[model samples]
Target: MRKEPLLLLILIALILAPSVQGAKKVVYVAKVEGTITEYTADQFQRYIDIAERNNAEALIIELNTPGGLGDAMMRIVSEIQNSSVPVIIYVYPRGAIAASAGTYIAMGSHLIAMAPATSIGACEPILGYSQNGSIVRAPEKIRNFYTAYMRSLAEESGRNTTAAVKFVTEDLSLTPEEALKAHVIEVVADDVPDLLRKANGMRTKLPVKGKGYVVLDFTDVQVRHIGNSISDVLISYLSNPAIAYILLNVGILGLIFGFLTPGWHVPETVGAILLVLGVVGLGYFGYNTAGVILIILAMIFFIAEALTPTFGLFTVAGVASFIMGSLLLFGKGGGSIYLINRETFSMLRIAIIVLAVLLGLFFLFGMTAVVRARRRKPETGKEEMIGAVGKVVEDLDPEGVVKVRGELWKAVSKTGEIIRVGETVKVTGMRGLTLIVEKAEGDAEWQE
Candidate 1:
């Protein structure tokens, strides 16, 4: 009787085994609805890892994007293609699109499904750093390469390669039904649960969760949604084209303000922090180097106009550089490429010009005041300077240093006389940065 009871228990356990496994079945879901970036790739990778570790049925990425950097898109594609768990890319939320980089990502997944009214394609490979990425025509070589690339991805997934090639060459776009009919996609569902139900028993060529060439069985599954983390939000904000641009400009202005009004460390300290962060974003995104240098130089020139004696030249140069740098500061390099559309670029351009003009006027008037201050004396016989007597702090070999009105000034000997340090001199005139100085009468103290 004991043996019979033990045998009955063993049989019962065997009968319940399949149901136990099915009960544990889960589907990990993550959603993306923005321009793709490395941060996006990182977020997706996290979800994929989670699903793989838990041995989930699939990790679905519901996406809606107008494309993004090529490098970032490639990473998303790579992770999806090589993942151990089944990766389903669903263009969801109805009326969403898998455009440009989005299309490439969708094609690389083990399974692709779409919601009603959702669309895909229009993924012509843009030259990484073209003047404008969206509408600009790519080179023939690039077109051919991408055509072949898309075809390869489609071929590998056992989808319609011809339609995939047209996505690059002809910029073809399709709705859910069209993609399903063309075999570019495998299923169309309204939502996550619906997608899982319809995708059951779907044949996938790529390996999933370490299994190969098998039909997926996703029924009565538990669903877990992986939302973005704090880091994701931070990186997404930092890498945004508009936000980054504003950060860079505001940081530059803050620094300028701090310089104009010294003795208050608040603006300088805050500006330094913002400027550092902005540079990191700009450089991290691969913005043009010349653009960055120009903007930095503009700062230097603006500071010089305030602190040094320049004849309005620095002010003009600063404004010109600011405009040019603003133009080149964004959408000029490859990684995280953005602000490529003409409409957006036009608005940015207008803002840059307006800011530059306003700044130019402010500095110009400020320089005029400096000129008037320098020319305070009667111009009857004097030329560029107020006559003031002071001591030489540095030796003058046609150029040196002097003190006038208890303030230091760069000076040059009026008559090519080499006056040693500690000698007394008279400020006869001033021009630009240099003060015209001459030996004071009855001056005795001099350095040998």
Candidate 2:
């Protein structure tokens, strides 16, 4: 009987053990689009942290970007290289690209996948702006650094180092087929489901600091898509070059309008906040000090005009200065090396011209009309006759005629005094067409 009980206990424990130890497969999918910046880096880290905390089988980054700042890219690479969970970078959705900094980030991942028609490469580094406002490549020294960095990523990821080096030097781009053939990418799939199916049980090495590599088993992992949080979406939008530029100018205009119209604290406060944010947006790429100075001078001119009403002279000057300042703002290097293109520059120039012209017209004519209305004297009525003195056209016998203000009027004497035809009379008051006159004193000349 005792032996039977022991056997029963062992059987029950064996049945329960598999259920207790089996872990569910969980894959985290993080979507990355637009220009990579500090916001992107931060959000990427957050995704990884969440995945690791959840004991995820893998973290997949869906990447589609034109590139971004070197610092932000490198930070993202570092985060990926140091992550405990395996990171799979997938260029997805049938026509996405991973260019410039995006190429660097994709290489840093444990595995890279692509959807149909997706592409990669074009890792050349654009250093900064030339004096003529065109982009220039980095120096040989910088080029070498990038070449070696890319080569390292290729070597560490077990991809083609030679081809990767060419990507930096020659700006060699690759289609999905070309990348796979060049050994730059592992595989291509139509969608996430297909990607997971293909990537399952794939062999890959994960980096562990100091210690070499930790092989991860990715067999039968269940994939799950994680949408961006509200903050993530907002940051992504704010990081857009066009949007950031608009915000910056809007802030400047708001502040100027507030200052011009005194006692409007709302616009001023909102403008201050926006200006600060705009500066921060510019900081993401980098700003030219010279450009910033020009913009400040423009603002000064605008403010001076508002305070002293230069009748659009200062306004016109300010507009001109602002256009110049805006042109030079990104002349030095910043985050997105190729962020400002020819089309963007042209659009900005046109916008500045239009805005300046509109503002000039408003201040020049609108404000003038308002001031004139406030100071104009009444042209007709009793107010016009109150202090008039004129010559008596006919002798006034308590009711005679006088010429006042170049117009004839019948006179009624205030003191019934006789006024000669050549004598001047003072208009004391008026009733209808008659002037209430008083005799002019000695040497008093009537001015009609």
Candidate 3:
């Protein structure tokens, strides 16, 4: 009986030990919506780190974006390519687009899935302008180089090379069903659970260092979401063309206001913070150096116009330069390309032109007023009569009163020329409440 009890205990121990030794499988889902900026890159890196730390089975990135910066896209692609865990790109929730840079990211992923109503493609290098604002196009050579790079990524990911080329060269797009049929994507699913079901038992070749290839078996997986932090979300939104432009304008206007009227530190502080944020956002969007230089030149012109009267020339030139610079500020990347929208640019141009004209008029009037004030006669005490040419209003015994510009003032004569009432004289100096006068050379007839 004791031997039987011992055998039963051993059986239970063996079953429990196997259960304890087997690890629970997990699937990490990361959602990327909107423009993929530097914050997106940071978040992706963070999620990758998290996956690595937890030894997750795979990382699924649900991507919904119009596109973003080229450099950021390249960084993301590099990260995806180098990731040890299987990275799946899924375009979800229907009506979402994976244009430009998004195409590169999806192609870079180890596995790509799409929602039934979603579409992808349009990997063509748009040279200038975006849905958000205007952007300068890359040089032809550079664009070709990026095209070749994306092609290589497609090849590595086992996507259709011909279709990939068409995407870059012709801006071809594909719906989920079409993408699957063309081999641009692996599968189509309604949601994450369905994705997990379809993804389960799927095998992928891992790029392990020493091993030739390790197969991924994502069976019986636990799903863990990797959502963006509030800061990350804010950064991503602020990196948009519209938001960036607003921030840039606010920062510049605040700074100008602060400079014009000192002692209000709040505008300056806000301006400094906004300027930093705008610059960082522009950098994240891959702005050209020339565009930035042009913007600086525009600001210089604006300040110059404010300080010196340029007859509206500097103001006009500044507005023109600013519009052009803003139009060419950012560039298109593999995923998201930043460009100024046509309507926005047109409105901005009009506003800038109007502002310039108004400022020019204000400076013109203000400068004229200042010149007039400088030429006007002094209105204060005795010093006001120093250079005045006036007539004696009363007979003076070397000291009396005089009339100057319709005002009577106390006066005296330095040269002992007897001054009679109505005798014309010129002011030489003054004593408290008294003006010293000299007989006018050409006004002797008036003294007769």
Candidate 4:
């Protein structure tokens, strides 16, 4: 009977062990380091879903970005607003930022934190690019929509709605210290551990489906960062505007090279793939239609230059068009900073101009030289000596001399047949400046 009681106690201990381990708190962390495209939004949502499914204590997003597509930003904000688990947005590490769209995302979180030397805001919406290649702000109605949206996020998160509205209207930016003072951020932490420590015992309201609010207490949280998959990494890399722009131009160049040198399929095939991808990327980032059309026109100018001799006129036009089109590809503060900053734009313009000049030179002088080489009479060359009928000026005991084209060249008989002087022979092959001559028709058995 005592053994039975001990056995039951052991079973209870085994069963309780797992629950004890499970009681250890877990916080799902996602680090969003770049532009928040659709891909990034998906990755972020996935992390949130995982955290909710696992009953995590909280979900933390480490945000550092220059901004991204508005639609993608909205989706991320929506997911965070609807999540049952508390969402914490932290601008982490030294020298990190959460600008533009990032500011809205930060405001959407239940608890917001920032590290030293970090900043938030600059949320003025760049609605689109103007036809003249300037940044166009959202119209009154659209601007009001975002301002109201941001104000609501601030109100719900218990932040300063006035400051949030200024973020949209006046491009208000704030440092971590300033943000904390303005009640825009909840805590200013040095790092993740410091953040969790500061966040401990902090109570925040999580929105329930029908219920009023569920108070979440952040206590004894464990941070577990989610790693990005290969596809996610690739999408982030290609989302860079500079990379996309370069790929598009290189694709155009490749197609030109493939067309100039016919029968080469590799360049054209790769160019087509890259061009399609680049166009898709442009669309994904919501590039202006006018800018895209201008770029296509620039490419046409380059092709025209390659096909015809325009004395660099078409080439000049192509370079000018390329510079303008690139300038307008994405206006300042539009998408990723990597794409449309003044320095990058100027550098890319100069680089593209130089590339266009080099390609133009190749099409004009290089290809012309090749054509001339092909058409020129084969005079004074090895090919010119072939099939020439020459008189055997010296006897050939397989080694002799022949006069052809008014010049005497060292000669040998192809068949080792003896040939006397004054007999005609045909030039066959040349070895080390010596012509191999074969006996020609009507030259056989010439009377000695």
lDDT of 3 by residue, 1-448 (tens): 8899999999999989976655688889988888777777887888888987787788888899878767788889888777777788899878888988899889887788999888898877756555455555667897798779878987776779899888887789999989999988887999989987887776552353233344566667788898778887678767765566657766876787688669978887898788778787766655666666676677677667666745567767776777666655653352144454466456645654665456456555654665567669778766765666888888777788888777788888888667999778887888777788888778443321
Off by over 4 Å in 2: 1-22, 128-135, 205-220, 333-339, 366-448
Cα-based TM-score, every candidate: 0.73, 0.76, 0.69, 0.77
Whole-model Cα lDDT per candidate?
0.80, 0.79, 0.74, 0.78
The better candidate by TM-score, 1 or 4, is 4
All models, RMSD in angstroms: 11.9, 8.3, 8.8, 6.4
Q: Give a tens-digit lDDT track for model 2, residues 1-448.
A: 8899999999999999987555667888989998778888988899989988887878889999988789999999999988878888999878999999999999988888999898898888876544445767888998999999999989988899888999999999999999999988987999877877788767654464433454445566667778889888666666555556667777877898888777968888888888777777777666676777877787778777656766677777877777777767766544234345555656655765776676566556755765576568776688878777898888888788889878888888889978888887887888887789897777776776
The residue-by-residue lDDT of candidate 1 on 377-411, one tens digit each, is: 66433452455677888999989988766668899
Highest TM-score: which candidate?
4
Q: Which ten residues in a row have the lowest lDDT in candidate 2?
A: 332-341
The better-scoring model by TM-score among 2 and 4 is 4
Model 4 per-residue lDDT tens digits across residues 1-448: 8799999999999999999988788988888987768877888789888988888878888899888788899999898888877888999877889998899889887789999999999998875544433656767888888999999888887789899999999999999999999988989999888888888777664363333455545576667889988877776656666677777877877787788778979898898888876776665565555566667787787678666646667766776777666666665343322234454455655766776667566656754665567668978767887778788999988999988877898899999999889888888888889999988788443222
Better model by lDDT, 2 or 4? 2
Put the candidates in lDDT order, highest first. 1, 2, 4, 3
Q: Kindly give the stretch of ten consecutive residues in candidate 3 with the minimal lDDT sum.
A: 205-214
